[model samples]
Target chain A: MRIVVLAGGIGGARFLRGLKAAAPDAEITVIGNTGDDIHLFGLKVCPDLDTVMYTLGGGIHEEQGWGRADESFTVKEELAAYGVGPEWFGLGDRDFATHIVRTQMIDAGYPLSAVTEALCARWRPGVRLIPMSDDRVETHVVIDTPEEGRKAVHFQEYWVRLHASVPAQAILPVGAETAKPAPGVLQAIGEADLVLFPPSNPVVSIGTILAVPGIRAAIAEAGVPVVGLSPIIGGAPVRGMADKVLAAVGVESTAAAVAAHYGSGLLDGWLVDTSDAAAVAEVEAAGIRCRAVPLLMTDVEAAAAMAREALELAEEVR
Target chain B: MRIVVLAGGIGGARFLRGLKAAAPDAEITVIGNTGDDIHLFGLKVCPDLDTVMYTLGGGIHEEQGWGRADESFTVKEELAAYGVGPEWFGLGDRDFATHIVRTQMIDAGYPLSAVTEALCARWRPGVRLIPMSDDRVETHVVIDTPEEGRKAVHFQEYWVRLHASVPAQAILPVGAETAKPAPGVLQAIGEADLVLFPPSNPVVSIGTILAVPGIRAAIAEAGVPVVGLSPIIGGAPVRGMADKVLAAVGVESTAAAVAAHYGSGLLDGWLVDTSDAAAVAEVEAAGIRCRAVPLLMTDVEAAAAMAREALELAEEVR
Candidate 1:
């Protein structure tokens, strides 16, 4: 089977790890969200893309679920010592190499997709990984603060630096309106037996991917089972501050609300955690097939089991 | 007394340490060579300027004579793992931070001179450091290989990668003819009470500085004593492969021969190592005042003594 997975950072990477293990024979093509990409120290940093790449390539810090294992902060410390900052974003020496290579290639006129391919040649993430759009599409969050009144900050500053402390008044995927889907994105969606949205932040991760002009339309019409696993369980996010951004978009922090947010038009199947088993009927009533399964990716096996459940649900919807 | 020094990499940096110790109260301005600067991994790597800064700022590796003390090569090793290279040049993690800051500032439309000043704000290397030119002036060595016939390679590739093993048919400071001296370079030379040449490479280091359109004229017409310590100790360079490049310019690698190469019009006094005492008269015959001194900069104290001798010779010429 050919499976197309739309991924964000840690949570998505963990789910994809399970998906790969569950469907070992399937060809996987990952459309990584690049909205979280930021230029730090004049180098391009694609947090989501690198997270997926490192996780799959065995370079990831397993406990943190993002960044390289055994990484050193010498470069970051030196940069800080030089008074060059955004010191909160921890870019390790090993991680800076990825950004440097990516920035160099991008500055040399290679599109981000081509650069991603070249970088993946080293990682060999098993799946063909492509950025959602080669064109720049940064996710910015509008926050109200007493000092600044209200302002739009880069997603990284809002997430990494601010720790999502301040309330997000609005979440904007800047430049998404004009960005064309990267070369393989639409084709992968068209060719896939089923499309899966791993438990990633709907507002800024998968949501930003869908915001690109042609991508949502292509997936909606791909004629394949479009399955989604909820990032929310019970009434809270399983990981990350998904609820904060969810509030910015006015979506309730609940599995059924998230399923309804993706809506029946684009989603054919939705998986909620067993903790939110009560929400399955409400999701099914909204015309999308719904199933409650153990959604926590506690380990590789747990993630693989969730992946199997999603695939089984896709089959049931088909 | 106000002093101006033309400097290169390791040799120049070491000599400056001695100069600083010798002339503790003398207002010293250093016009650093920038032709050796190269873009490595898409970041500006100013070898000579950085060497001067790191050496004086107490960040330089004592044994290696360049780069930061206690440096790690994690960034470099990671870059190599990604197969991104020209790995012969050792850019440690700490060193990469400097390049990143410089490249960012340059990209943001800051001239190299301004960037150098901002960086110096952190290093605070005591002396006012200026590049010979803000405009790019790469030293390219024309070398013949059995495979490629003849090609002009970057100085770094020639010196670091090829180890100057190949004979240089020509040494060209590629952009010097069109390049104007950087701000304060000519002014510093014109305002100086005396100018000193450190035991740096005559061909690529001091030669490249003189190649900047107005700098040589400024020094010559400034009417201050221009004294130089010969890099060639006996019949060879005290350190580094200065002979290979000196030959490219048709200057023999000898203390007396190098003094004649500069000529009396530009040089007022010359200091050769005591071992080359016999050649002092020949240098004097070229109409420049010449002296034989213990020119080996084996330690800071020895370099300081050589600086004192050079200053005393400058007073005699005055």
Candidate 2:
């Protein structure tokens, strides 16, 4: 099977790990969201890309579902010691190496896509990973600060430093309107047997990927079964501050709302947790086929089962 | 009292600590060699400036004479894991932060001099540290590589990676001719009460600083007594491979020859180690006042005593 997966950070990374297990023989191409990429300490840190790479390559922290296992925060601690900070986004020593290498490559004039490929050379994540856009398309969150009122902060500062405590007025993918899809992104979607949108934050993750100028159009025109799993379970995000960003886009923090937000025009099939079974009718009523499954990825096996259901749903749509 | 000292890495940094102790009330301005400055992994690594800062700030690994105390090499280890590196120059996690901050500031359009000052604010290294040149003037050592034949390797790669094993055919301060003195360097030398050259590597360190267009002329014209301590004691360097580079510049590795190399026109006085007492007469014959003192910095007290001797010799010249 040739599958194209649009991924964000932790949730998408974990889901991809399961997808790999569900279809070991499948050729997977991951279109990693780059809106979350931030230049910290002058190094380009692609959180979503790194998370996906690490999780699938067996280097990810199992407990955290992101970053490297046995990682030390020595670099971050030292940076803090120098009074250089944003001390909130915990870049571990091992993780810092990836950024250092990526930044080095980028500084040497390598595109983000080329740099990602070079990085994946070591990880061998078993998937062709391409960024949504090679151009700068930082996700900025508009939030009300006590001093600055409604000011746009980089998505990282909003999520990491503020803990998304304040209400987000809007989520802006700063350069997406003009961003060309990274090399091979459109081709991956065009040739895919199935396209999966894992339980990543729809607004900032998959939504941001879709916001890039050519990417959304390419996926919609790909002529394949497009499936999505709801990040919301029991009317709250299974993990991460997805609801805060969802509200920024004026979307309700529910499985049915999230599926509807993606909509039938793009998504032919949607999967929700058994707990949100009642929302299945509400989602299917919107012209997209919806299935309620045990969507909680409690373990790799559970995640595999969820992937299997999504694949089966794609077959049903076909 | 105002003092200007031209310094390199470990030896010069150690000597500066002693200079600080010897003349506690003196306003010391350091002209650090940027010829030793290298870009590793796309970050500017100012070894000489960092050594002086860390040594004075009490963060230096005393035993090693460079790098941070109690450092971790997690970042280096991880970089190697990614198959990205020379993996020879041991930049610990703590040290990486310094480079990252410096590179970032430089990229933001801050000159190396301003970046050094900003960094020293945190180190509080006491001395007003300035690079010999704000412009890039990397020391390149021409050596015979087995694969590349005659190639100019960076001084750090020559010293750190090759262990200076290959004979240096030439030690070129690559951009010194076109480079101007860093913001405060010439002014510091011109207005100094005393100017001193610590036992730093002459060819790549002090010599490279002198190679910068106006610096050597400034010291020669400065009204204050210009004194130097012999990096070469007896017939070899007290520490470091100064002999390897001295040979490249066609200078003998002897206190008297080194004193003569600086010339009586620039130097008013020179201090040699007691072991090189016989060479004092030869140095004095070249029309520069010479004194023999214990130059091995066995301890801070010993270093302070050496500094005291250099100061007394400067007074004698005055």
Candidate 3:
């Protein structure tokens, strides 16, 4: 089976690990969200892409579920000592090499897709990992502050620096309207046996990918089973502040609400956690097939079981 | 007294430490060589300027004489793992931070002089450190290999990668002919009570700085005592492979020969190592005042003594 997965950072990476283990024989193509990409210290940093790459390649920090294991902060510390900042973003020495190589290649005129492919050559992520769009598409969050009134900060500053303390009045995927889907993205979706949305932030992660002009239309019309696993469980996010940004987009922090947000037109199957088993009936009533499964990715095995369930649900819908 | 010093990398930096200790209250301005600057991994690596900054700022590796103390190579190792390199140049994690800051500032349209000043704000190396030129002036060594015949490679590749093992047929400071001196370079020379040449490479370091259009003229006509300590002692360089490049410029690697190379018009006094005492009379016969002093910078105290001797010689010439 050929599977296409749209991934964000940690939660998405963890789910993809399960998906890979569950369907070992399947050819997987990951369309990694790049909306969280930020240029720090003049180097391109694709948080979601690197998270998936490192996680699948066995170099991820298992506990944090993002960044490299055994990483040092020498570079970041030195940069801070030089008074260069955004000090809240913990970019480690080992992690910085990725950005350095990426920035160098990009400066040398290679597109981000080509650069991603080159970086993946070292990791051998065992799947075709392509960014959602090579064109710059940064997600900016509009926040109302007493000092500044209103301002749109880079998603990283909003998420990593501010820790999403202030409410997001609006979440904008700036430049997504003009960004073409990166090479191989539409083809992968068209060629896949099924498409899966791992438990990633719907508003800014997978949602930003979908916001790209041609991508959402391609996936909706791809003629393959389109399935999604909820990032919410028991009315709370499985990980990350998914609820905060979901509120910005006016989506309720519930599995059924998230499934309905993706909607029946694009989603054929939806998976809710067993803790929110009642959400399945509401989701199914909204015209998409729904199943309640063990959605907490406590470990790879639990995630693999959830992946298997999603695949089974895809089969049932087909 | 106001003093101006022309400096290169390790040797120049070490000599400056001594000068600082010798004349604790002298207003010193250092015009640092920038021809050795190179772009690595899309970041500007200003070896000489950084050497001076780190050395005087108390952050230098005492044994190595360059780079930051307690440096780590995690970023470099990671870059090599990604197969991105010219790995012979050992840029440690701390050093990479300086380059990143410089490259980011340059990209944001800051001239190298302004960037150097901003970086100095952190290091506070006491003396005002200015680059030889804001415009790019890369030193390229023309070398003949059995495979490539005659080719001009970057000076860093020649010095660091090839170890200057190959004979340099020519040393060209590319882009120096039209390059104007950086802001304050000529002004530093013109306003100085005396100018000193540290035992940096005469061909690539001090020579390249002089190649900037207006700097040599300013120093020669400034009417201040221009005293130089010879890098060459006896018949070889005290440290580094200065002979290989000196020979490329058709100058023999001897204390007396180097003084003649600078000439009486530009140099008023010259200091050779006590071992090269015999060359003092020969240098004096050529119209430049010469002295034999213990020039080995084995320690900061020894370097300070040498600086005192050079300053005393400058007074005698005055």
* Chain A TM-score (model 2): 0.99
Which residue ranges in model 2 land beyond 4 Å of their true spot? none
Q: TM-score for chain A of every candidate model?
A: 0.99, 0.99, 0.99
Chain B TM, cand. 2: 0.99
lDDT of 1 by residue, A130-246 (tens): 999999999999999899889999999999888899899999999999999999899999999999999999999999999999899999999899999999998999888999999
TM-score of chain B in each prediction: 0.99, 0.99, 0.99
Total clashes for model 2: 0
Ranking by lDDT: 1, 3, 2
Top of the candidates by DockQ: 3
- The CA lDDT at A22 in model 2 is 95
* TM-score versus the correct structure, for each prediction: 0.99, 0.98, 0.99
Per-residue lDDT of B1-318 in model 1, one digit per residue for the tens? 999999999988899999999999999999999999999999999999999999999999999998999999999999999999979999999999999999999999999999999999999998999999999999999999999899999999999999999999999999999999999888888889999999899889999999999888999999989999999988999888999999999999999999988889999999999999999999998999999989988899999999999999999998
> Between candidates 1 and 2, which one is better according to lDDT?
1
CAPRI quality of model 2: high
lDDT values of the candidates?
A: 0.95, 0.93, 0.94
